[model samples]
Target: MAQIGIYGLGTMGSALALNMAEHGFDVAVTNRESDWIAPFISEAGDLAARLHPYTTLAEFIAALTPPRVILFMIPSGAPMDAMIDEITPLLAPGDTVIDGGNADFHDTRRRTAQLAERDLHFVGMGVSGGESGARHGPSMMLGGSAHSWQQLKPVLTAIAARYEGAPCVAHLGPDGAGHFVKTVHNGIEYVDMQVIAEIYSLLRNGAALAPTEIGALFADWDRGPLKSYLVEITARLLSYTDPETGHPMVDVIKDAAGQKGTGRWTVIEALRMGQSASMIEAAVGARGWSSEKATRQRAETILGGAVGAFDGTPEVLAEAFLAARILAYAQGFRILASASEEYEWSLDPATIARIWRAGCIIRSALLDDIAAAFDQHLPQGQLILAPQIAQTLARCIPSLRQVVCSAMHGGHPVPALSAGLSWYDSMRLGHGSANIIQAQRDMFGHHGFERLGRSGRHHGPWWD
Candidate 1:
């Protein structure tokens, strides 16, 4: 019998099954579309030796070792529910079902409880690094009980990416924690990509540089503190030329971007938790705005455009990018900390950082510093308050200010960067301008306000 079973043959599912097979774990594989099985096995090359393909669900379930470990890489919502309903009766006590998709944490939590009533285990796992990473090694975040972890640890550790000899995988918490962490990871990714795009706009429009020049600049940035998988890929993207038109590949691509709702989910959850994720919000908003390409074009024609130039050096731009990146990450971490408290999951920012340092889209050198900061136990769990991060901010904030100011003058929209700076400024203020609003609220809505010295709620003199 196969050691484990995977019930999907899409890009991710196929790659993951091959990854397990290559690692010497016989993986029984099946798919909703039975035709996909033969093509997948044929493409597995020599790895097919360890792959046992089953076309039917019953046979697939029967092929796995007793107390079967079945991983579902299908769509997260109704599809997952439907699959569970079909598979639950086939599973025995102690059998585990893993949802290896980008699922909402709330749904994961509900499913976890639902499956437990039947004496079965449910694991919501967050897998990152895309197709190539799946075939080799991806960062894996698992949320389940101790028993489920014990059953899957050996296979997961072998297939996961490693950083400094340690697997970039962990049993984060129970039920929804892993998926929640992945949602935030994607949220941060949205801001990261948006910020880079904004910088590219500044370089292309304001600086009047060619795509190859910008690509060279990004390649250089990849060798420095800004080094990350995204930056590396972006450099290659900008440098590549379209075979048809001979234009830069990025130049020929449409401006409109698409999303899969994880970023919006992150923003919604942050608002529900009463925490600010302004950078992510800005990124999501920018994506929405990008989709209305015709509207943007009409607005540009009606409103005209700014004609100023960027006076900053590449070094200054890099510094500004770094500062904005740090602020965005700080906001994401705050949301994670808030969710941990609200859910009683005790999510570790340090462990999250360490795991993200490799095999993830947002993996970067900055995560090392973030991990170190959390290791020191940041005050109030605020990443911005960490001494090392604070010092880096001190050095980079001025450059960020210069970039934002220059971009505004140049009529370039840098929403994510601007939001990051605004959040940072708001956070550093000891006193804010909200007292007048509070007094107005008391006058109009009869919502009482507390006086500076007094403890109990007090009314403002405006009512008199």
Candidate 2:
């Protein structure tokens, strides 16, 4: 009998199955439709020997050994719930069902509870690294029953991305923890992409530099402290030439940005939990606004203004970009801290940072530093407040301020950068202007405010 059964032979599922097969694990595979199996087998080549293909779900389930591990790379939300419902009756007490999808954490929690009643183990897993990562290795975040994790650990650890001989997979906490962490991972990715795009805009519009020049500059930055996959790919993207048009491929591509919902979910969760994640929120907004190309084009024709030339060097701008990037991570991890408390996940921020270092889209050299900081220090409520991180910001923030100022005068929109600065300033301010606002609130609606140096609430009589 196969050690694991992988249902749903989509791109992700097939890659995972291939990975396991290549690793000499006997894997059973099935799909919602039968036509995909032949193509999958054809792609598998010699590795197909270890793959047991099944045409039906029942057959697929039966092919696995007792106390089987059945993994689903299906659609999230209602479809995921439906799949679990369908499989519950067929699963034995010790059998485990793992959902390796971009599922909402709440749904994962509910499903974990629902499966527990049937004595079935459910793992809400967050798998990252895209298709190539799945085939080679991917970071896996597993959360649910500890017993289930113990049973599945060997198989998952063997297949997960390794950094310095350690697998990127981690058993986070219970129920929804894995998916919640993944959601934040995606949110940070959104900010990283947007900030990079904003820097590109600054270079293009303000510096009047060509894509090739910008690409070369990005390549240089990748060798420095700002090194990351996003920056690496962006350098490649900027340098890519369209064969047909003999022009830059990035220039020919559509200006409109697209989103996959996880970014929005991160912002939503942050707001509900009363944590500030302005950088991520700004990035999501930038994408939303980018989708309004028609409106922007029309407005551009009607309204135009000259912008001053860029007054900063590529190196200086790189420092500024790094500052904004750190702020974005600050916002993301802070939200996670709040959520961890609210959900009682006992999340290890350092562990989360370590897992993200290898296989996730947001993988960066900076994560190693982040992991070390979290591991060595107590919770300061914000990653930015950590001593070393604070020193880094101190070094970089002046450049960030200059970049934001230059961008404003240079007429390039750097929403994420602006948000990062705003968040930093607000966080550090000893006295904010909210007192007058509170007075106005109390005057109009009798909303009470505590007087300074006292504990009791007081209402204002503004008319008097």
In candidate 2, where is summed lDDT lowest over 10 consecutive residues? 375-384
Give lDDT tens digits, candidate 2, residues 1-464.
99999998998999999999888899999888899888888878899999999998899999999898999988998888888878887889978889899999999899888988888888899999999889899998888878889888988899999888889999999999999999999999999999999899888878899999999999999998899989999999998899999999988999999988999999999999988888999999999999999998888888864667887888789889889888888888888888889989999989998988887788888988899889776445568888888999999999999999989877878899999999999988889999999988888888889899988988776645
TM-scores of the candidates in the order shown = 0.99, 0.97
Give lDDT per model, in order.
0.93, 0.90
The total number of steric clashes, by the backbone 3 Å criterion, in model 2 comes to 0
lDDT computed for candidate 1: 0.93
Query: For model 1, which pairs clash?
Result: none
Instruction: Output the TM-score of candidate 1.
Output: 0.99
lDDT of 2 at 203: 89
Q: What's the residue-level lDDT of 308 in candidate 2?
A: 70
